[model samples]
Target chain A: MDETILKTEEQDFIEEDICVAENLVYHKPKTLTDTDLHYCPGCGHGVVHRLLMEVVEEMNIQDKVIGVAPVGCAVFAYNYMDIDMQEAAHGRATAVATGIIRVLPDKLVFTYQGDGDLAAIGTAETIHTCNRGENILIVFINNAVYGMTSGQMAPTTLPGMVTTTSPFGRDVKTMGYPLKITDLVAQLPGTYYVTRQAVNNAGNVRKAKKAIQKAFQFLQQRKGTCFIEIVSNCPSNWKMTPVESNKFVEEVMIPNYPLGDLKVPKEEQK
Target chain B: MGELRLMKGNEALAEAAIRSGCDAYFGYPITPQSEVLEYLSREAFNRTGMIVLQAESEVASINMIYGAAGAGKRAMTSSSSPGISLMQEGISYIAAAELPCLIVNVSRGGPGLGTIQPSQGDYFQATKGGGHGDYKLIVLAPSSVQEMADFVRLGFDLADKYRNPVMILADGAIGQMMEKVELFEQLPRGGTYSKPWATTGKTKDRERNIITSLHIDPRQMEKINLRLQKKYKEIQEKEVRYETFKIEDADYILTAFGLGARICKKVVEIGREKGYKLGLIRPITLFPFPFKVYSEIAEKVKGILDVEMNAGQMVEDVKLSVNGKTRVEFYGRMGGIIPTPEEILEYFENKFLKGE
Candidate 1:
């Protein structure tokens, strides 16, 4: 040894060893394409997409599952998810999913929609598709704002939350209260399973993934409309960093949208 | 073997849809066309495993059609005038997305729910691209119960061929009237055409396809519009269908479609009996509007009578086709009232032949 400080290849050796060990702990879901996500860094959409792909890959139903993409932030979901996808008109994901399910009843059909796409313009479609008991999975992302259209007030936006359209904070007296669409949909007899969840932390992320998995499982049983409402975060629209947005979801958003199972089959009820 | 049975135009069209191997029918009940949904709901599922849904409203029905059509299934919806108006927005989206589907407008009178009786007021809405944007539907104006049944299969074929929505523009009279219809044999499922672009599901062999009308880039959107325009041009050149009666050595011509053509045909016979030298041109496809035939007739005939059930809606197209080369006159009945052949002949004799 020359006694001069020499950088060793030990760092590379250690990294390789750790990666081999980590292989048992974590791996990218194969259903997710290699393309990098286009979602904002702090956005919850990426996490939701990953959870969905993970479920898809783990279930080994990639070829049989068809997804309907809504016309919001998740519009480009087809680019990242390796499954077949149909892009629906604004608020028409449930309708589109109903179509796919009807024509290919053997296939697993799911719709990924935003709050605006579900509770606003597509309200009739959402309500009727559920009422009709279409055996499909609906993953509704309630971010309290229209993330794709740049912070416009959504039907799920908090009563007092400030948005671009409600710059002075939402006035419930004039603008009407935020819609409890999950609760409303749960009342429909056609809906067999309904849940409201959040993905703010690792533990919550695991729970949200479970809920989505349950929804798909119910659809497989042809139990009827399986709806999973995920109250997520839009960090950029909320004017916060990813860390702060996660914190906000815990403190402020959770109070407005509590996470739990809203409805289930009588036998599975808890 | 195919069977011939007496059927209401609406029911015949519904039967024809099932025989055409239509995958789905999503609709709401509306007068003059409720038989379509009622018949399909009662029979389509048991007969062919077709999906028939009674949607919440016309808006929901049309959106459901958009969804099914996007999945590369043959879907259809039917409504009267008011319901059809509610469907225009969804129809426009379907058109923009380039999804193939069938829409039957068993038209009643309208400006706003005017009447539940027969009227051809939706002629402008149909041939002019009812919803919005620079778009067109392959509008087939069915004048008889036979045509109503025949056009269902024809509409689906044309829609599949062009990847565009097709409209069977029937009126209340034709939709409600019962006549003998020769039903076609059921075509094999998946028929003669294949949808390579449909969003059925993704297989490993091909990249995932997205059915969308959204192209943020203006240039890209313009290219889509241009593509649709070129397709429409091809349709115009190849699918311009019309029937000419007694055009041999005629001095006056009558142009009409749907119920209007039925009345005009009678008027043509009446005029010819009176030795006024009259003929009729019934444009079967309202969109590809027989303009070439009209242009040719404009030079040979001295005048043309445009008859319609509304306040002279199709007359504008008639004028455009004639281009002031020969005199074109209009005679119309309004608000759910059907024009009589005698009145139409009187209007024609007084307006165009006599130059009154």
Candidate 2:
């Protein structure tokens, strides 16, 4: 074996080739536009949207997918997704998905919901749809605070967290504790996969993409309800900058709500 | 061609739905209307792939209907008094979206969770807007099991014809009573029944479509309202259906619908036997309200007797259609108490015969 040393020009060429190969291999999704997004400057919805579009393109299911948009900040998500999309009433996306799937069984169905939509007024629809074993994917964004409604306390707001509705720091005696939707849905036998991931760092973002991919695969297999709850950060609602919001998510939200798979199929474990 | 069978009105409605190529049904179990859910549940998954779901609540069931209708498939739901109230929001959404679906309201006593018995209390709710917004459901009032089956088919056709919701405003009496009905065969699926505007899936040939009612611009909303009104006008002119009784040279015309219409038939016979010049006008389509027939009768007859099971709801419609040309009198019984034919004849005897 002969050891070879690379020249400076060769090293530069290798770096340039790596960059070109990366562009060819992991191309950006065409579903998104370069125009400025409507989200706040440091909002996590943009990241989630990009990740979802990448999954849609990678799976090559864009033509056959239908997204049920929610009523909050993501109400206009239909404008971004290239697939067929429907906007549902504030908390009735699951019900709408049930209708669509029952009619068009071969198409992929997914819903993007915030914590308030999934855990509050739409609790019955969300829980019952999962219990009924509807073959659909649910991407629940748990930001611990309501962003669209001007910084109100969401159902996932932790104790001691302050919000418009919880000015006294979410009094446990009066406001009750935060809701754990992933854990609650994990108990149902109809749910095939249930996981919680965050988006505060690159490692967690990679983990979130994997979780989303698995959820979509589960749906493709006609397995039951696959739910991926992302503990997103709302820097605008938290009254912090982007970096500070990521730090708060890493330091505070993860401790109160630990991240990991709460439920998974036994056969897939090994 | 089929065999004649004795079936309850609710059961007949369920069978009619299956026969009319209804692919999906979402409903919650409620009193006086549970037979519909039961029958659909038993037969929905058998021959063709019919989706019958017992939703968590009436609200969820109607939203499911909204979803199914949005996909451009034949869908339906059924409920009674209190449950129909819960479905108002979803109904409004369905109407606003302009999706073709069927809804059945088996009326009972109301104002709240009233008793589950026969009453004509939901006339205003069905013919007028049950839900919010300026919308109309093509209201068909079926008096018997035969009409119940017939109207289900007619309701679906009219819904698709006008691209709007159609309702079969039956009552607890019609829902519970059994009658002989000739059942029709199921229409073959995937024939000529695909909606191009439905949210099936994105295809390269067409741009993405959205089914929504939110128009922020005042002028655009007005244009949409104008188009909807034009559709309603066309429906009114083309889809008016009714049954006429002996009204030539008659002095009084009795008008009613659903079970009340059946009772009015008997009242006509009793009044004829009693030598009273009383005819009958049975409205099959309640929203259209048989106005032309009423206008003719208003010119020919001396007065009109508007009979119902509730405290005078359809009387308002009768009066409006008559347009003050003829005197319209109302006789009603509330809280699930049905009016007997003799009671109505007696009312005619006292209020019209002796008073005249």
Candidate 3:
């Protein structure tokens, strides 16, 4: 058993290397831990996690920001994000975040949730948390499917889309129209910054990263709830290759769910 | 000792929580227990920096406690039967996560919205794992307004000591009744221990703290279960609490808890007045039940009467403890009914002495 123990280099134990400095233009963010993420190739969860942690690192608030992980595919987000985190029950991330922020109002708090966890089972908590204008950031991942559950129909699944639960193709009339919860929350007075972005491409990734940065900055300013919804893709669950998934995200998903800032605070208010 | 005041059980509990220097309270309005939320709303913030928020629902309130407990804070919530039923999912998560917090159940009649009146119908749900999975909640039954005031501090201490959820199981009778209580002096916030493993954010000196109940591997899950079981076994050994009266020379033993115990005290006196020697045993810690006393006393007593306000709930535990050494009879009311001492004494006499 002792021989079977495979010890790897502990975080930059090989940092004094002679040949590795010049060629590297960018490196992994310090906010991300060394643990391998379990997300599949081309999965948007990994990118979002990276972007969120990158923002946490850039803002120098890595020691102050506490995250709440959701119950969907990102349930193990704490393992990768290298921040103090509490794993929420399915759809209760916002409520859990509320608890943390209320107890220690000085700490920066945020929650990362998927569509099923956020828009479906946790709809009440989400609406009320936003309505209360909880002074925290909310990162919503709308992948249109329950990726962890192998492509079940989520509340954001498009009309006529075929999923495991809606195998015969989702009927908008029977299955209920695909929910645009971001649009609904944007209308609420509690939201200080509400935006929708995608990470299916390089440009989109940069924009999403900026949204995350502003979300944290707004939270630091003690603004009301900062909600950012990301249009993402599921490759394995979508039964498509990584490239095909990205293409599908652009051609099909983007048209259905347009990406832009839905609600922004007034310039004078900031 | 702090100043004494006449207070309702729910109000006393809320006031005690404030004095205990609790960090936050997340609660919802429920009958027989709404005063707890109301009292805290009026007093918690101004007295100390304690946070008081009326959550969206019982489900939200319990998860809020979970979040607060994860961060190593003293947080609590109170609700009645139906609301508690709604909180089962979050309670199960908190239990599995091994987070310490307090939950008060001002119990009422259940089985699908039975009544708003006090009932002990939640015994099986409280003592037995009310939620899913194999978990035992440390249950403290408060019988009076004074105990209600005292148990808030005790519950928080026990929770932090074991890093497990502790529940104060009171009922509508206790929650609504008014009695003079000598409150304890105010303690500092966050209680006795400094939780090093709390998810309070990662600093440069320590690794990140992750508060989660998820263990996808079967072996890891089994190990978590075993750890919880070991902790529970230790609690069973060290935390068994009960109060016994006149057991030195009695032939009959009367077993009850909370209000049942208070009523049984009267029944014991009534029986003693009628030339019958009777004793009473009230279990304070219901989960780490005084199983040894019940089993040992079974040898000396001629019979035991289990009194409750539900359909033979706690009687099952009593019967199991007695294990056929002596007759264990049960007499109780259901659907928010409380039997008088005369009624209980008559039933005992008819069953044991008259052999009816």
Candidate 4:
């Protein structure tokens, strides 16, 4: 049995590509390799991870980038990214990034956060950090549900979406409403660029990579905070298969929270 | 090398932190210690681009320190009693992560919004564990404005030596009162002591380093604790610092720290003039406790008078250090009331001299 497993693992490794291509650019993704990812199958987090690494390699910022890992499902981001990373307390990635950027102003600093981690527990930290006009990039992953803790409703969960806590469908009368962070943060003058994108398909994935690259580039230009909110799918938490999750994201999530650039300064506008 | 200048204790501490080449200052305004923040704010931007941030709250100030220290910068924060209590969680996190930084606590009356007068009620919190955890801060108790200035520099050096958080424990009297002081020369900035372990940026040649206190395995935590204990033991050997006065050939010794020690100094002077052999053991490093010196003195002294602003905190440590080798007694004034040297002398005359 051990011999058979090793043979199949080797075959799978051979099948997996050593490099990735996006927008007519070929880049080597970091060695995510045979280490079984802790993410649930068909989760959007893995796709986001691959896209980010591809950007890191393509822009050749792998050496100059510092990643602030959140305490959500992405807590184990250190295991995937080959670049320098630090794990922050729940919802404190921005505060930690503020410190990092203040000390090493030249380095590119970015934080990866989830809806619950960023919008719920870390709301004050996130808001104050943006308000401070910290020269850092923020890649916010809004999956609308808590994936790691097993199907819990997050602050960005759409209205009427049900979870373990909001079992009978999130009641607008009691649970308030889903949060639109991009729209809220975009109102602040300190923000250099704020955009909301999705990752349900290859085309959206391409757009996300471009947005992330641009955000990093803006930070390199000494512009203010650049935030990219990536609307993502959580199949395991949504209790739907991979394909159904993508369909739900397009048909439900996009309509309530439309995807587009919510804010871009005239100087930063392309 | 120069003439003495009359300065508030808080101002002295500010000058000392600057001279020590401190990289950043993050603080919120509180009474009795507000001048420390004010002085730092004025000079911070001029000298080598020192970062001084007037944070929104005591909570934000300490968290900012956490961030700066994580980047391997020598940062500090100052606050009074109530504000210090609010910073306990951040302090514990800094201690657990073993980050080097300085915290100044100008104590006032406490146990919930007491007077702004001087008080040693924070003795237990400062000497023992103030925050939740099995950890200790390298606490320095300064008796005078001169010591306040001197200890700020020493606190930074000690923190760097042990890679641990250090606290300069003062009170409203030491913080508010003005006294003569001789300032030291400033240390050169842009030295070679850079934290290579800090998470500044990711480069291709290095793997990303993560700074965290979370440990899932119990055994792993135990190993970490043991490592911390070993480091603390080393500190005990090398960093135990104190001052002794009139102790040789004395029949009795006065054990005190901070302002209490200053009052005790006066008591010792007058007690000796009256032909009673009274000495003093003033602990500069409260965490190290100067146990060896006190243990040795126990063999020669008849008893120890543990004087403090609180009812009885350091007396417990004095008693433990004496270990029944000598009789240990205590005298205290609480709730923001400071005891003068004359009152302490009268206590010695009435409590020990008259009784004996």
Encode model 2's per-residue lDDT on B162-239: one tens digit a residue.
779999999988999999999988875422455888888778788776777766679999998888888888888888
> For model 4, how does the per-residue alpha-carbon lDDT over B1-356 read when each residue is reduced to its tens digit?
94478999999999888878888888989987999899988876697677777776777678777777877788899999999998887788788878889999999987798888888889788878888878889999999999999998889888877779999999999998899999988786522366777766665576566666666689998998888889888888889999999898889999899999888888898888988899999999999788999899999888889899988999899889889998888899999888888888888888766665
* Stretch of 10 with least lDDT, candidate 2 chain B: B186-195
- Separate DockQ for every predicted complex: 0.64, 0.60, 0.73, 0.51
lDDT against true structure, model 4 = 0.84
Q: Fnat of each prediction?
A: 0.62, 0.70, 0.82, 0.59
Candidate 4: pairs in clash: A63-B202, A63-B203, A84-B208
lDDT value for model 2: 0.87
> Which ranges in model 2 have alpha carbons more than 4 Å from their true place?
A1-28, A33-36, B352-356
Expressed as tens digits, the lDDT of each residue in B1-356 for candidate 1 is 57989999999999999999999999999898999999999999998899998888888778778878887899999999999998898888888988999999999988896889999999999988778799999999999999999999999999999999999999999999999888999876444778888777677788776777777789999999999999999999999999999988889888899988888888878888998898899999998888889988899988888888999888998899989999998888889999899988877766566783
How far out, in Å, is residue A84 in model 1?
Answer: 1.4
**TM-score of model 2's chain A, to 2 decimals?**
0.91
Candidate 3 - chain A - TM? 0.91
Ranked candidates (lDDT, high to low): 3, 1, 2, 4
Better of 2 and 4 by lDDT: 2
* Candidate 1 CAPRI-style tier: medium
True contacts kept of 3: 0.82
Clashes of 4: 3
